[model samples]
Target: MSLQFIKRIFTSGVFLISANVMLSVTSAHAAVNIQQWQTSVGSEVYFVENHDLPILDISVNFPAGSARDTADKSGLASITRYLMTLGAAGMTDEVIANKFADIGAVLGGSFDTDRAALSLRTLSSERERLQALGLFANILQKPDFPESVLAREKARIISGLEESSTQPESISNKAFMSALYGKHPYSLDESGEIDTVAKIKKEDLQAFYQQFYSAKGAVIAIIGDLTREQAQQVAELVSVGLPTTPAPAPIASVPAKNQAKEQRIAHPASQSHILLGHTGIKRNDPDLFPLYVGNYILGGGGFVSRLTEEVREKRGLVYSVYSYFMPMAEAGPFQIGLQTKKDQAEAALALVHETLEKFLNNGVTEAELKAAKSNIIGGFPMRIDSNKKILDYLNVIGFYKLPLNYLDEYNKKVENVTAAQIKDAFNRRLKHDHFVTVIVGDPKAE
Candidate 1:
């Protein structure tokens, strides 16, 4: 079937499900009227007023991720964020949880290398909205980092760390990142070593929060049943209590040049977990579109992808093999990961390396490019079929300073990516001899 025919069927009501999906796509891409502004306290606010739902979703992001942790205090940032919701002002953790539940509101948050975020979803009614916002602001600005709670969380994290050390997947991932980033802060796992986590005192969490959780570092994305005026007010409430200071400068990019190295750990696992790659592109890299489309065709598109076809289907060496580039503030790792029987690990690795080299030299075919773009474009609506998903995109765009029309332009950008562009971008960014490899399990000796 032609693209136009699919579009017509989806855009029209011949099928209710397809029509509804298309309507969601239209609303997300075309009606995503993001209004942006800066609060007096220096927080950047991105707002979208959607009255179709009687719910409100607000996410407040800060530049306080694990990357900001000092080497000695590696997990402080994550612990600080986790503790923020536990105890604030005079309220206990139970009190905070009960307060949100009493009013039918939900509290959520995340921690990663480059960012820390806290989110809220609540009914848009005045009583619930005001109460929830009040609770959120308190958690953001008035976190107590209670000493008893600190000890308990530290014990919990250390226990988890001790368990993770024996897991093959976790061991390989940690070692792979260390090899890929060397001394870079990005190498540090969000969950720091047991020794470091055990040493983190309550004072450390308080100090870290005070230093990095400033108004200027805030990226507030608010969406739902609220007027622009109300959104402005909500943004102010979220950050007004924060200290007014500019955020720290962006982290430096990972070095593009590095010596290739291999790390093999002796583990008694039945299968070997292998991971390989090097520093990839940053969020604002010029070749973002080409690389995005190219990676999909190479290994990210599942069964149709080249890596899957060669490593899994043709040889039956493994159940799955995949590759992806994690676009971040600095150059993130371009990882190709897989698992295979311990005896077949060497063969699997050789095939993977050959597949990558061949694709880099020859690039994808026209048919592959066309199918990749079609699949990516067709799947766009599923990405933003809900308020939470749209909120996530909005939050990222605001946090990373991405263009407001990123969602609308995404499909067009994929459609325009050419095979030549993919080859050129891939060749320039990924060097065959400069990647780091980590394998955990018994394999043939070199």
Candidate 2:
């Protein structure tokens, strides 16, 4: 199952009671009206007021993801973000955890290639909301980055990196990113390498935090039981004490690949893990709609995709094969990943290439186009079924500077994509001959 689905299942029980209460106030099809503004401290705010449930969800984002790290300090951004919640404003990690539990609140974070985010979920009642918002603001404005916690977290992360280094999937992923991105910041693993992470000190984290986690660069997304005035107050409180430095420079451009290259690493595993592709579009690329729809037909539609039909069912060369375009602030990888017996690796790879070539040459049929549109547009509501989900969309919209109507017009964009548009997008955005390939477990290894 997908990680998102798994997360939904895991967290469903925690919010079951609140979700039922919300049903009486609003239907699943309620419209989302987002309000956008900026705080006096220069933080941008996106608000969606929904009193359906007595719950509030807030996410604060900054341009402090791994892409902001220097080569020598590859994992600095992630570790800094983690340390913020562990201890802040004179509170120990245990104390912070206990306080949140007492208030029935949840604290979480997301770190990726482009941004770092801290999220909070809590009851919207006056007492509970005030307590939760106060603690959240402290974590954002006054992270202590204790030395003892830093050492422990460093050890834990190093242990994980060591273990993952020995796994074929990890091996292939790191190699694949390095091959595709080269010297770009995106190539650095979010979890810093052992050598680099070990050298990181408490001072480094404090400096990094001050530099990238400045108020001027903050994007605060708030959804749930709050009025426009209240949201403004909350934004001001969260951003009040943050550093007032200017926003950091934009990330460097992702370099283009000019030739196809393959790297094969020998391993003792019985199956070969393969990854191949080149840099694709950014989040705001004009071809986003057409490319998204076309990919559904090419390899993203599960068993119904052209890749699965050609490589898995017809020839039985592999159990599963999939491709996706991960659009980021900059061009992200357009990756196709698969696994098969070592003996069948070459055959699976060949069939994948053949299928991609045919799909590009012929484009998608009208029937395939209709089905893709139907599947994508039909499932749009589920994307914003709850306050928490809408909070996520607000974060994306504010951080990426996308049109406020992005979620509103999502289905229309998908419906308007034609076969010709899909064909042209695919042809212009992807060059099969320039793909970079990484394989773990040498197919010829015996």
Candidate 3:
């Protein structure tokens, strides 16, 4: 789904990895060695050589996502990345699509808050790999951002945006983010408003792409059946043509909002969608493991989480409820989201607040901590079982500048987190009085 260009880029296939092997290797973080180096073109490259299969996966990440968009040009980054594959070096989008298909290679991309990326997976054979990489290079460096294609895509996206605006969940999410982030860049909707997107000209996209998608601003994550030398070559081939400039400055921090803000919008929907939270930790925060484990205990653990237990099982307020902290380049959101019958909206909201307060004050019980650690540690192997998953972690590590041994240290880190650590981490980072809450739906008649 991150690859927004085409819905079906590759056939439905999972890169099979041995779950048992992964489970057994939990003690060793060096299960797969990650080689890191800078390319000739200034791109930071992270390579993991896996010859288990004749598959090659490479992801090129740029600090050019929605966060980089100006207040008025909210969707420009996403639009630019989407259009890159449409036309490059005068080849139309159809020609590019056909080229990949003919080679049995897949080209895809994703756009998010802190980054945009283009990814490819292809057979490791020289013929196929070269063909795919060649096309990828052109898209990365020589994107035409053709005027006609721009117009078409803009219209398509605008239509989708217009449709989404009518949906309650969409409305709720937008309102929630706007309230949470205030005027910070993170507040902008991932997709721009219809008016803003309509104003995004080819010139706008070109300017944004040129400044933000350069080699210095990128990270190349390569995983598969390739040698270190080949990975170096692959990294260079894709980035060498990019403008060699200094990396841009880090994004501004989310302005602190010490006051609790609540936005209520009436909708005809039968269920109320409620979301609440505040600015959370950054990717590299020292408390990352503690927060991760704590969140799993709080609400991220699904069926076993405190939220699910109190909100759903004890009171049956909602069918499903969850919470998570998204640690990005800067502090991302720590959010709890749920939907319940319109009549019970207020009760559900109160219960959520009460439970969070109690957990924040008392922290998790020893039994709860043990359960969370067990679940997290037991499930850790599945996270790195596949090359694609490993590639994703590598991309994040390179982009966020995480420690190279992060994967190896993951299980141990979770295991080492004590109940006091979780409680202390949450107490320090989370402020109950300063959170933003948004509810969308008509309240039931009392």
Candidate 4:
């Protein structure tokens, strides 16, 4: 916000210094007052001090991800992620929950192919925030993995997995990932298979925790009413307490596409579950901005998107049809998927393919480019509307080592992106024929 905007807010009788307004301003400046440090015991830390609100958000990630899980014990990382805060270092699950409740804090986490993260959001009222953060730090740095809690969380997790197995979407996703990744560890679903989850033991969790929770692989991001010293303390608070050393990074390669082929799986469902994509752009690809804007014109945006207008509005091929590419460490998959009646599956699929093929050839129209630009540039402010959202952007920026003026230059970049650029970039990189298409449903049998 400019001084004039603040003046206008003041003139309108809004608090001359509302905490939310202050946070928005600080994030807009995007200089992040980011402080850096290392803990005495060897933890790397990143900090941003904002005295705007009485709220603190802290998140830490380590390499304790599925890539590190043993092949036979694929789900162990996921189970460990859930069980950490369930009980840790002399604290029972009930006691842990009660302690957090007493202080009005929440703790949670998830493990994915690349990393595992634990996070907490709490009121920055001195003692409550400290108490909550301390407990979270202990769990990450020294989880007890108590036997009973592990047993219970595993059982609950297994139950959910079994239920998921019956869903067509889950089946299609499993097949899609397995087919796309081939023999790579990335193919293993983070939730793991049923037998794998069953084999997870308390000791496994402890060993995995010990190896991957080091500060060397950790990234901590925080936004709140904390001083630079306080934020560093909080970052060091989480990981320096852990055994220090970096886990060996994984050796993985992007899978190649076996495009122009169709594989069908038999399933008992009303509508076929459809998934399609080849490898997509990597997280740090230079083509990021151009391709992103191009994709919005293609599918990522709803209703106004070419995919929706052609597949849904013109032909009524399916209730909803969409496409997206998840940029990851390597080229991720670009997928276009939807479902119609069993008999209409082929017809719907045909229309989707035709629309995409046309898009690949002609690219987006001039009107489409104008609208996409307008919608994208118009709503860019919401990208950093909240501290939490800004933290997400900062995480990406920090992890990807993007330019400090990324947000400031956002609009200029969008404005400079022409229809010709979108077309050229999409055509150069997007090989639709390279993607594998997987359909799971008894369309023929039905």
The best candidate in terms of lDDT:
2
Better of 2 and 4 by lDDT: 2
The clash count of every prediction, one per candidate, is 0, 0, 1, 1
Error of model 1, residue 298, in angstroms: 0.8
Sort order, lDDT high to low:
2, 3, 1, 4
CA lDDT of every candidate: 0.86, 0.88, 0.87, 0.73
Clashing pairs in 3: 29-408
lDDT for model 3: 0.87
Tens digit of per-residue lDDT, candidate 4, span 221-303? 68778876466456655755776666457547775665555678888877887888766777777777778888887888989
Task: Residues 1-446, candidate 1: write the lDDT tens digits.
Answer: 22343234323444222232211211234747777777767788888888999999999999888889877888999999999999997899999999999999999998899999999999998778888888888898899899999999999999999999999899999999988887889999998888899899888887788778999889998899998767766776778788665687788667766589998888878889999998898887889999999999988999999999999998999867999999888998899999999889999999999999999999999999999999999999999888899899988898888888888888888898999999999999999899899999855532
Question: Model 1, residue 26: displacement in angstroms?
Answer: 19
Off by over 4 Å in 1: 1-29, 444-446
Give the alpha carbon lDDT tens digit for every residue of 141-164 in model 3: 899999999999999999999999
TM-score of each model, paired residue for residue: 0.93, 0.93, 0.93, 0.88
Write down the TM-score for model 1: 0.93
Q: CA lDDT of 299 in candidate 2?
A: 90
